[model samples]
Target chain A: DAGITQSPRHKVTETGTPVTLRCHQTENHRYMYWYRQDPGHGLRLIHYSYGVKDTDKGEVSDGYSVSRSKTEDFLLTLESATSSQTSVYFCAISAVSGSYEQYFGPGTRLTVT
Target chain B: DQQVKQNSPSLSVQEGRISILNCDYTNSMFDYFLWYKKYPAEGPTFLISISSIKDKNEDGRFTVFLNKSAKHLSLHIVPSQPGDSAVYFCAASAGDKVIFGPGTSLSVIP
Candidate 1:
């Protein structure tokens, strides 16, 4: 119910290609995060941004990159997509860095063949 | 290693009955704990949360019980409904970072 939105809700692409996912929020929250959901593994954080131009890696940041150029947008990029990168990606926004709640976007499903 | 663990992979409860989901954590220094519910094909939504200083917190039909001494927590849904059927994930946070458990699928038989 948060104003978070993710672009390219569904996509099928070939391996070794560059892919970027976008997260936009209307709430103007300070924290935005990217996570990939997989079976049995739950959801793993790939990267997060605390503020515009400020970003950090997460537990499963390997082979993934992210950038936040504006307060409303956070982008997750796969330098070169791999089959292993195929998963449902979610974007989240929190009002503060240490807040207990974070609102999530619908999600983006990407498949790498 | 997983900092948070949801031992049960799935659970079933009859409609209008109580549904109890359990979670255990390895780290004693976690500052906060949270529960999230996810429907198929959708991102997770925050259901409830409790701080380390609190033992219990409640909202509507949902309540979270935290036992710091045992490094455990539990979520209880009273009079469970079909809409409550979803995958539940328990997460722990230390400062600004948080870690998630594998998730437990809950089915409410209506």
Candidate 2:
């Protein structure tokens, strides 16, 4: 129930197309993260941002990019969408960098045909 | 390689019975552990967490037991209810990075 929301809850796009998912938070937390949920694989971190304009890649950052222009918004972009990139994407916010609990947004489901 | 592992894919418990979910980690440097619950069509939510320094931490009906020597942890839910039926994911953190297990689905039969 944290003040977080993801735009385009559901979408379908063709392969090799550009796609961007947005995450917006109202809690003003300093840390924001993007994760993809897949069957049997659980959740894998794609990218994260510590502060405005500060970002870092995660365990599964391949073929994905993220940016945080403002404290309230974080964006995940796929330069060229692929079938492998189709999954439920979640955005999370945390107050601290490490050893801190995170609040998650509803999620965005994207499909690449 | 998976740093965190949940051996069981699914479990069933009768209402009012105890439900136990287990987790194991390979990293010895992990200093923090957490449990997250996810409902269908929704993102996961933090349920409870415990630091490596402690063996056990309890909050109401939920209790997390950590065995650093065995590199294992378990979450117990007493008097399980239907609302507690969901996929439970165990996570371990080493500094800024956290690894999550595949998740165990729990079905509380009424």
Task: Locate the minimum summed-lDDT window of 10 residues in model 1 chain A.
Answer: A95-104
Q: Model 2 over residues A34-79: C-alpha lDDT tens digits?
A: 9999999899889999899999888999999998989999999999
Q: Which numbered prediction scores highest in lDDT against the true structure?
A: 2
* TM-score (chain B only), all candidates: 0.99, 0.99
* Model 1: residue A45 alpha-carbon error in angstroms: 0.7
RMSD of every prediction = 0.9, 0.8
lDDT of 1 by residue, A1-113 (tens): 78999999999999999999999999989999999999898888889888999998899999999999899999999999999999999999999763478888999999999
For model 1, the stretches where C-alpha displacement exceeds 4 angstroms are: none
Question: How far in Å is the alpha carbon of A100 misplaced in model 2?
Answer: 1.5
Clashing pairs in 1: none
Give residue A53's error in model 2 in angstroms.
Answer: 1.5
* Top-scoring candidate (DockQ): 2
Encode model 1's per-residue lDDT on B1-110: one tens digit a residue: 88889999999999999999999999988989999999998889999999999999999999999999999999999989999999999999886677889999999999
lDDT of 2 at B68: 99
- Global CA lDDT of candidate 1, please? 0.93
Q: Would you list the clashing residue pairs of candidate 2?
A: none
